[model samples]
Target: MDNNIFGYDHNNTWVHQLTGTSKLLFFILVSIIAMISYDVRFITLVLILSLIILYQSQIKWSQVRLIVKLILIFACLNLITVYIFSPGHGAYLYGTQHIILHLGYFTLTKEQLFYELNLALKYLVTVPISLVFLITTNPSEFSSSLNHIGVSYRLSYAVSLALRYIPDVQRDYQEISMAQQARGYELSKKGKFMTRIKGVSQILIPLILSSLDKIQVISQAMELRRFGKNKKRTWYMARKFSRNDYLTIVLAILIVLLGVWFMKIDGGRFFNPFK
Candidate 1:
């Protein structure tokens, strides 16, 4: 398995040892809680816990640096866009405004900054868990785990195929790019931006044709095996829940409960430090 396929680390780690079902359940639960709540304190705690789990997974920074950079860039863009469009959104939410800096029509408020901070924390907390899950999970095992959790076997298999194909797509792109470069095609930094775009676009047609051919082959193979002919099927790669899986699930549930409790205590999702 290539470790670079969508940032998946093909290494042995404690996280990798856990059942795919458990990991998926944990991710789903955390994502739900993180997305639903707007409490800074709770989100910060989740961010810390997620980071700890990511660190414990023993995934190297180098493996995920590109993805992390992209996420950070998106986060910054989101923050800037939110502030630009709704500069007083935080004040509206918290019902108070303390101007930090005045800029004619756009005044920077502490409330807005804090709101954006929580929003950024939400991204920081959720994105790493998603990446870790992708990095640690085996596609076959993940599919089986999904089926174990009562998802339709067809859907599960589709998910598995998508995961399996990501690396193939990347490999195809690289091979095609190299082949083109060997033929004196310039798709490098030396090319002008539009020229590079046009050059890359040329790769897409061949890539798509190759992808379609591979898909047809795969479909034929699956058809020959009579895949999805039955409602239920056994999975050779499926894993059973272990004691650690139980513990991990329990901890995730506790965290969710704690988040809810925080929301109740704070009288809403926003933990207004200003008040």
Candidate 2:
């Protein structure tokens, strides 16, 4: 089916074979550790590890290329804004001012540049893993895993529906765009930027109507099936955790512990090499 857009496909890869619960747990643990630590060494290590896992995932670069580009743009904007607003933030944080260059109200210091580098590394590390979690986990299986972790079945199923809807929405948009194009509408990059935006905006009205209709159909079907009538339900896609799953989670925990250890050793989250 539309696996790429929805972020799930059946594959024989080891990452795909891991139980959804274990993968979810690992993602959460690692994400928390990444967000909490500012130690450059620790962040770099996690970024490297995440890249390795991403390579092992065997996800097609084409599927995520646009997203990667967007994240890169955003990360660059973030660094620029942070530096623009507080040019000496890094110096202030590290309690050192080794200036690299000085402008009117902005002075680029080694510490500030290093701080920004770590911030960029954090984004590079976390974004790919977040994408991996989305691209790898099966919605139904993930829903079941959420329930297994004591989440409400209704909430879990809602999450599953949201994930399933992404591809549907994308497919609808493409179909509508093609139909419009066949009717002599120009929505591509050949037109002026604003013109293209206007053309694309025209698609949204029909898309919304179609989405509403689909929602009604799905709601009726669920009602006829008496979905959510019971407090609990069995899942056909539920899977038992395997040895690899256990090992994966254990490794994630160990990495988080290592980050914590680095924080302790550094006496803070910021690793000051200048010191």
Candidate 3:
């Protein structure tokens, strides 16, 4: 389990055994459903479901701590930005404003807070499923799955290459950061927040260069092999769908239907409690 980067780490769990296509489709459908609906009940259920799926995968916090922290920081910034731009938007959506606090220009309301909660949950709803897909699915298998689903092999292979390259780029970043720290630049908690941010920024230039070099090397290798010379290519890593994969896909479909039903009952995706 790589602590610093999020990548496919082979685990002996049932989740890992499921075909990449099912997981990929689930990720895409769940993300779309979660984003389209704003009802807190539906969002919370999906969020909890996603967490349960993640837990069943047997992933550890230590393996995902860095990415989780980065996501949380972004989530916080998003929430703050929403409040700053549309403080009253929530009240307007739910059609009521139960005042909670009066911070001059920003009069805190129960509706606003509830709206924010739903927004936060919506943002979080897809995270675990995404992690499950990214961590459990093999890039080669994923590409094959995409091709199996009618995507061009070339396009699917490009996606696979990007997925395969992500961890390498992250590894390069880690090495560069360590070297910078060895030379007395602090990227760790030992330094101030801004200083650490600056240290990270300084490493980006070389990281990009390293990534470009890798791209060139890979392109040359592919060209030498005459890759994409044919219209369609066969996949050696293709996986057959199993009972579990079928059931998992069914469950994902059921979840999407549930979200749609909730939207219908809520009379347009946003649940109105004030009514």
Leading candidate by lDDT: 3
Candidate 2, residue 137: how far the Cα is off, in Å: 1.4
Question: Which scores better on TM-score, 1 or 2?
Answer: 2
Q: After superposing candidate 3, which stretches have Cα over 4 Å from the reference?
A: 192-198
lDDT tens string, model 2, 1-275?
24335456567789888988998888889989898899988888888888888888888876677688989999999999999899988999999989888786797799999999989988888987887777888999999989998999999998999888887888898899989999888888787888778889999999999999999999999999999899989999999879999999999999989999999999978789988
RMSD over all Cα atoms, model 3: 1.8
lDDT value for model 1 = 0.88
TM-score of 2: 0.94
Query: Who wins the TM-score comparison?
Result: 2
Which 10 residues in a row give candidate 1 its minimum summed lDDT? 1-10
Q: Rank the candidates by lDDT, best first.
A: 3, 1, 2
Total residue pair clashes for candidate 2: 0
lDDT against true structure, model 2 = 0.87
Kindly list the per-residue Cα lDDT of model 1 for residues 102-196, writing each as its tens digit: 88557999999999988888888898789789889989889998888889989999999998888789878888988898988888998789977
Better of 2 and 3 by lDDT: 3
